[model samples]
Target: MHVPDGFINAPVSAVAGVVAAGAVAVSLKGARRELNERTAPLAGLVAAFIFAVQMLNFPVAAGTSGHLLGGALAAILVGPFTGILCISVVLLMQGILFADGGLTALGVNILDMGVVTSVVAYALFRGLVRVLPRTRRSMTAASFVAALISVPAAAVAFTLMYWIGGTTDIPIGKVFTAMVGVHVLIGIGEAAITALTVGAVVAVRPDLVYGARGLTAPLKLRIDGELVDAPAPAPAREPAAAHRSTKGLWATGLVTALVLAGFVSYYASANPDGLEKVATDQGIDKKAKDHASKDSPLADYGVKDVSNARISGGLAGIIGVGATLVVGSGAFYVVSRRRTDDESVNSDSRRDEKV
Candidate 1:
């Protein structure tokens, strides 16, 4: 959930900012090991796709709506550290450019939406996948459950934060119940989206999905009409062909994201999301302040002086997708490059020692 300004006291909000900063720093280091040649570029597309899907808010309860938080989906497709960075980038972009989340409360949004959701969901996903069968179906099932829990976990996190630094007088119990209740319903949507997306990606490009790596069952060969476990051999392929396949998948994903954000987003629900609804109903939003970038040209996900609603929103969405892709890709490339550099140095040192 995007916590707008003034919902939390300055002291608590500052503390959250420190926590968020630390988390991002840690993730950057962790991502060096997770992001590689195959997955580094896709990280940007993952962020852009999350941004697009988030625009298509689905109705959950009576008037509240929900959208993909993308933590579970990102963690499953990429890696947990990179997934955290992906969602963080989206939150940062939304806060600064779209005036969607509050600039002052960026830390709260990052902590709740980025850190809590990614960490909890990935941990749960790994646990379930380990216990369950290592198949695509089991992977999808684990994704569903992980995504289902992550939303409420984030809701609870927000409740705890509000209890500490809430700007208005309200019963914490009531706020918790309402926030959790609505978010549970929202979680269903999240789970379905995460499962379907993960399933689709795994079906086409299982090698590219980080969670699916090394998940294939041992091959059983029919020897003399009896099935026997066969030693697995590494598959060989042309580098150019593999590169082409990755490019195709990337292009297709980017196009789909563009369509969703640039055109389909215009038809999304106008009602408040789960967090916003709960805040409004529970008096948590009484002290909410205007976004710092409310005067930006693209504030509120619309271009300045653009009278046409569809065009303005569409342009803003496209611009957002482009910016997020560039920033996310750049960050990932730098991390991946550093990893390559480290490997090279180690390789050279070992060679010199052998000499």
Candidate 2:
């Protein structure tokens, strides 16, 4: 959930800022390995997709609603390091542009929503995939479980942070209970969305899904009472097929993201999210202050001076998707370029050694 300002004390907020900074730094390095020519552009699409889906908040309880955290979905579709960066990009955009999350509490939101969920979800998904059958169905099933757990994990993380630097004197146990309870229900929605999205991607182009990599292989046959892996087949329209496949998938994904944010978001729940609901109910938001960008044209996911609610929200959502795609793609492109350069340098060094 997006943590607003005033919920956490300044000291704890500062600590979270440092932690968030360190995690981003580490992820940047790790992402060098994750993002290559094929996956780099896909990483940007993942960020934009997450930004879109998050706008469609579904009802979780009487008044609480939940949205895609994107940690599990991103990690399954892209890579974990890149997934963290994706969610971070969305959070950053929402904070500065939409005022959805507080600038002062950016670190808290990043740590809970980006770092905790991505790390936990990816680790669990990897473990489950190792034990379960190595099929697309198993991968999707594992994605669901990973996403289901990640939400509550994020809730627990927030509860601990609040215990340490809560602005109010709400009992930690009660806060934890409420936060976990609502988020547990929210997690089910997260799981279903993750599984469905991952399944869809795997169905169309399993090669594009990062988690499914290395899971599929050529079948083996028994010959002379011994089983041997099938020989690799000759290439068939290899380059043309790849070019067309990636182009089609990219076009389809971008179109889907635009549609979800620009049109479908209008029907999303208007209620507060899991964290916000818990905070309000527990008096944790008693000291919440106004967002710094509350007066901005695009604040609160609406265009300034736009009387039509639909038009205002639709424009804001479109702008958000476009901005996220540009920024996130630019970031991932740089990381991918760095990886290419490093590999080239290594190859040169090896050749010189042989010479």
Candidate 3:
């Protein structure tokens, strides 16, 4: 959920800022192990895809709507550390460029939407995959269940934050009940989106899906009437054709993201999302302040002075996708490069020692 300014008091908001900052710092270090030549670009695309899909809000209740939070989907596709960074990039873009989420409350939104959802969903997903059959179907199912719970988990997180720093005097019980209830309905939509996306990726390039990796059972050999694990296969050199295939997948994903944000987003539901609806209904937004970038050309997901709603929104969406891809890819590329540099340095050190 994109927590706007004035909802949480200054003290709690500052605390959340510190927590979010620390989490991002930790994720950056963890991502060094996750990002690589093939997966780094894919991670960027995942961020852009999540940014696009989030625009297509689906109706959850009569007046409430929900969109893909992308935590579960991202974590399933990439690693959890990278997933957190992906969502953070999207949130940062939306807050600064689109004026969708408040700048002052950026930390709160990142903590709830990025940190809590990704961490909780990935942990649950790992646990479920361990228990369930090790198959693509099981992975997709795990994604569904993980996504289903992540939304409510985020709602609970928000409720706790509000309890501590809510600007209004609304009863804590009412806020929690309403937030969790509506988000439960919203979670179904999240689950469906996550499952379908994860399934699609697993079908095409299971190697690219971090959660799907190692799902296939290890080979076993029966010798002397006893079964034992087979010798691990040596690493093979990647062929040019395989590299071409990765490029093809990346092209396809970028095209899909463009289509979703540029064209399909026009048909998305116009109703307020789960958090907005709950805030309005429960008076949690009584003191909500205007977004700092409300006057930006691309504020509110529309181009300034653009009379055609369709064209304005479409341009904004395209811009957002492009910006997110550039920034995200740049960030991930740096992390991947650092990893490679570290390996090279270690190799040199070892070589020198042998000399």
- Going through the candidates in the order shown, the clash numbers are 0, 0, 0
Q: How many clashes would you count in candidate 1?
A: 0
Which digits, one per residue and each the tens of the lDDT, describe model 2 over residues 1-355? Answer: 8999999999999999999999999999999988887778889989999999999999999999999999989887888889999999999999999988889899999999999999999999988987886566677889999999999999999999999999999999999999999999999999999999988776667667777666555323344776555333225658777777787888899999999999999999999999989988889999998999888899999999999999999999999999999999999999999999999999999999999
Each model's lDDT comes to: 0.88, 0.89, 0.89
What TM-score would each prediction reach against the true structure? 0.94, 0.94, 0.94
Expressed as tens digits, the lDDT of each residue in 125-209 for candidate 1 is 8888778865667778899999999999999999999999999999999999999999999999999999999877765666777
Give the worst 10-residue stretch by lDDT in candidate 1.
Answer: 227-236
Rank list by lDDT: 2, 3, 1
Rate residue 65 of model 2 by lDDT: 99
Itemize residue pairs with steric clashes in candidate 1: none
Screening candidate 2 with a backbone cut-off below 3 angstroms (N, C-alpha, C), the clashing residue pairs are none
